[model samples]
Target: MVFQNISTNTKLYVRKGNINIEVKKKATGDRIRRSLGLEDTLSNQALALSIQNLIEKDLSINAFDASLDKYIDKCIKVTETPDDLINLTSLWHKYIEFKRKYWSPTTYANSGLVFAKRFSKLKNQDLRFPQKIQQELFENFSLDAVKRSCIQIKAAINWGLQERIISNVKWTIPNKAFEQLLKRQKEENDINPFSNQERDRIIEAFKTDCFAREKGRHSQYYFAIHFWFLTGCRTGELLGLQWQDIKAGYLTFCRVRSQTNVGEVTKNSLKQQHSRKFPINQQLSNLLVSIPKSKDYVFVNKVGKPISFSSLITCWKRVLSCLQIEYKRPYQCRHTFITDCLKTGKLSPSEVAKLVGTSPAMIYKHYLGAPENIDVPEL
Candidate 1:
């Protein structure tokens, strides 16, 4: 594969190859080529940063080279300076594009979902500011304004820094802000794993639905939830599971994919490397072997696509209602796994982290919050 100094040419004969962007802007040679080093989020960021760097170099008054200048000018067309720099939406869209280009398909979708929920509010709401984008505007916006949105917002801001859209001069958040938000969120929700009795109740309730769907669809959902509890895998990982991924005592998933409704239907997207193997314990392995490999989805709807989150919601609500048990959340499976692991010492903190695809610090912080009342036996 080869790359040519094609800013001078109207058409680029694109092929399935990589580009190497590390070399200093070379003299307008006959050809220019580079390689894309990796395919994950960090790698994508690297590629975008490299391109952003080249553009910034050209932005400098003294920076000049005919071929590179022409290339940079063309990039400027798609990557435009916003008429309203202070507007967060403009900055977010640019960063979203960058994120889409660099992040894994799953990460891109997850980030977009988070961004849409967290930052889209107050859209087009005017925050009067300098006609020119001020780095200070971002530096000083009340952290409260972006608390829930901060994680992804910071990602976009950091991208802006790389692209030279926002200088790092006064653009920084309080170092402790993110940590606090996370700590608080952990305390409030996402950690209440269901108790053993409650777990059994849900299981029994679902299994009792003999006529559900007049077929096996409801049973499949029940089985999928069981798999989620047993494996401590994310909902997506469970939904995206393919029978082909089973081998020996291991079940594999690349990044698990999920669907979304953003006015249009989204499809299964593996957010993490779904190829990683999980211990297909004797029971899970045997159960998997018995189930017919009828569809590509490990868990599908009646129509045979991946199960919608709403499916679980409806099933869970009815089951909880029938059992007369208080409802927590469908994600309690994850929380339950964490608590169970901690109490039983099935795996050490670090080991649990890898198995669950999160950090030890996160596991401890998000889980292990004591219940309001301690269980004590009478003396």
Candidate 2:
């Protein structure tokens, strides 16, 4: 499916089951709509409706003094702004470009991965961020997108607002949309880690089954799963480990690659940047003893190449298919570990937070579930 509009700068297309959107400032290819997230979901008459609505709304709005091109240019130049669309888009581009320059190869891949599959259904969505009753409308959109795995949609939308593609006033359609999205995305991205039974099944599957056809040996899969399961490390972190990083009875994930893999490997500063340390649990410790690690990476592809996070996911998906288990992701292991710990006994939220490399407050808000009801003896 391909969407082309002579009147609008945005063009959407599908390639190999993935949506690729290319936005031009005009037909001549001066690009403005760098955010292609809406590419997949905007097709056919839906595309016309989306463009018509935005254009109509922009014409109607009191926020911008000018049209789309003038507004976008002003935003890129960072002049005065009365709307969220210009400001938000400006920040979004800055962060994304920065991430590209600073993040690791693996870190960079997750965004693209999520963009492709999460919003694959978004070929044609009515993206007219409702003007009145905006708060209510934004919350509903946020809740729906989160469940569908398009949590970043709101953030990207905010960027559009900041850039002045959308209005930018506080409590305006764009701003309220941003607020609701951030709130809901956090709530929705809860860790439903693999259960004990599922964990056991994966471990078993890795040990016994051989997929990928090319690799006859199951040793690598077994070790990778065990390592990921035990540490609750991000798939890439587990795959990214070097022999040198593993010291006497400890694995230090102090230096994680930035999402882009463009800069030198260092601590992650971005929310997406993950730099956490995991203790040497029994499972990992015992497994480490048996495996003869020769290369820099603890986990490698069958070719003995270091596994990037995306590559690990491809393998993981295959593993899940083989085991016939409901597939989440390797990150779910970390979620499982966190939730599992909370269930066992009372550990200070701060203590658990430190181990997981997040705030204690975050633990309770997202993961602690409901508070316990204490029983009192009748007097």
What candidate 2 gets wrong by more than 4 Å, as runs, is: 1-171, 177-190, 210-219, 258-277, 371-379
Give the alpha carbon lDDT tens digit for every residue of 228-303 in model 2.
6666665435655677777776777654543341222334332334455566867678888787666676766567
| lDDT scores of the candidates, listed in order | 0.55, 0.53
For candidate 1, the per-residue lDDT at 121 reads: 35
Can you write out model 1's per-residue Cα lDDT over 1-379, one digit (the tens) per residue? 1222223222122234433343333433333444433233322332333343454455465464444545434332323545334345446656766566666545554465345423333323222432122233345455444453545555666677777876532334554755675555544564677898888767666666743545553565777777777778877677667777777878776645555422213234444433566777787776676565665666666566667776678777766776778777777887787778777866787788777777788876566555654366799
- C-alpha TM-score for every candidate: 0.61, 0.53
On lDDT, the leading prediction is 1
